[model samples]
Target: MTDLWADYVDASPEQAEALPARGPFGDSPALADELLALVLAGGKRATSGPPDPDEPVTVGGHWVVSDGSDRERVILRTTEVRAGRLDSVDDRFAADEGEGDLSRGYWLQEHRTFVRRVLGLSATTDVDDVEMIFERFRVVWPPEHADALD
Candidate 1:
């Protein structure tokens, strides 16, 4: 990870002073790899989850996305951030996620399951009441990877 960051800083001199957040998607190795592949293939552009108090995402902030083994794959620049109840997720945002059937119904069902397992919510808990942070981003590094998707 450090080497990847160094290389990025070296290539983009303007970002030499920037400190970006770094992490892989999902809670496990297999899931992280799956999501990373989706991002790389231009199938995913948005994600949502519980807010992180220590590393709140901001528009224009950079993030180094990694794979299952922690190999940095791309740098993503945040374009938008929205906070709302889980039930508030809409069709547009769901399609932007590029997952399942790219429908709001699929998103809701999948997220409800995710929340229950990952957030430790009981089956009876109302996932609609949970707060969620939705973030939209564009890949910024490795021009070829970003360009191919475009």
Candidate 2:
């Protein structure tokens, strides 16, 4: 299978670039594709990381987001980064995630499962006050192409 970014880099060494990326939910490719689609559609603008004091992706960093097959789909530029307890996530950020009715209740309910079921965190661990990294980013690739006119 073709690695999209590698092929691009090979074709255009001067223009092509690479950045860090990972599947949306660790190694789950299917969910990664779905989440990437949400971003592409302007439905998802932010993402949260698991409880970790050390931030992984930093502000002003770029990411090459990929799909289920690990094919590069979009480029994302981090615009903001914040860290806080998961329970402190407000409605605005939850809604911006574009998932499950766009409600805080939904975010909490779904994230609980995501943190446990998907991420494989300790099921016995208390979720409240867990350190969470929130990142806001902007899509930088697949520019809205439009026909040029004279």
Candidate 3:
């Protein structure tokens, strides 16, 4: 899986150019929808679906599709995030331990765009370094929700 992930990430034309990236991800990172609910629900009730008013939704970690509803709930933990990656597909933790899974759809949507942008930037900028180019791509690309060019 690591190899596959590496292959996908390395294939980015941006990764091929080597550009430097600068900036902080910022507060209130993006959410993956249902996963946030499970963490806050707590216990067995911590499955996905419309969240309970008492629970605080967390967008990280492994999740469960509710008992009767076809929704997923995630388990939030402070140690499950890395950059934009989730620690557990079911646990939405903060990214400080190492590389968490960065395959969430929201992240992918923007990342794909960033890759394309980097290619264009590297092809035009004074910087020909692929890695550096990928870095710059992240800034130019829009958020995943901005996936639609509209």
**lDDT-better candidate, 2 vs 3:** 2
- The TM-score, computed over Cα atoms with residue i paired to residue i, of candidate 2 is 0.76
**Residue runs of model 3 more than 4 Å from their true location after superposition:** 1-103, 121-150
Off by over 4 Å in 1: 147-150
lDDT of 2 by residue, 6-88 (tens): 65456447545445454443347777877877887788888886744343778766667777886767666677888888888
RMSD after CA superposition, every candidate: 2.1, 4.8, 21.3
RMSD (CA, angstroms), candidate 1: 2.1
TM-scores across all candidates? 0.91, 0.76, 0.17
Residues 111-147, candidate 1, lDDT per residue (tens digit)? 8888887899898888897899999999878776663
- Per-candidate clashes come to 0, 0, 36
Model 3, 34-117: lDDT tens per residue? 222322322112111111234333332211222123232221111121122211222221111112243344433333344445
TM-score of 3: 0.17
The order of the candidates by lDDT, greatest first, is 1, 2, 3
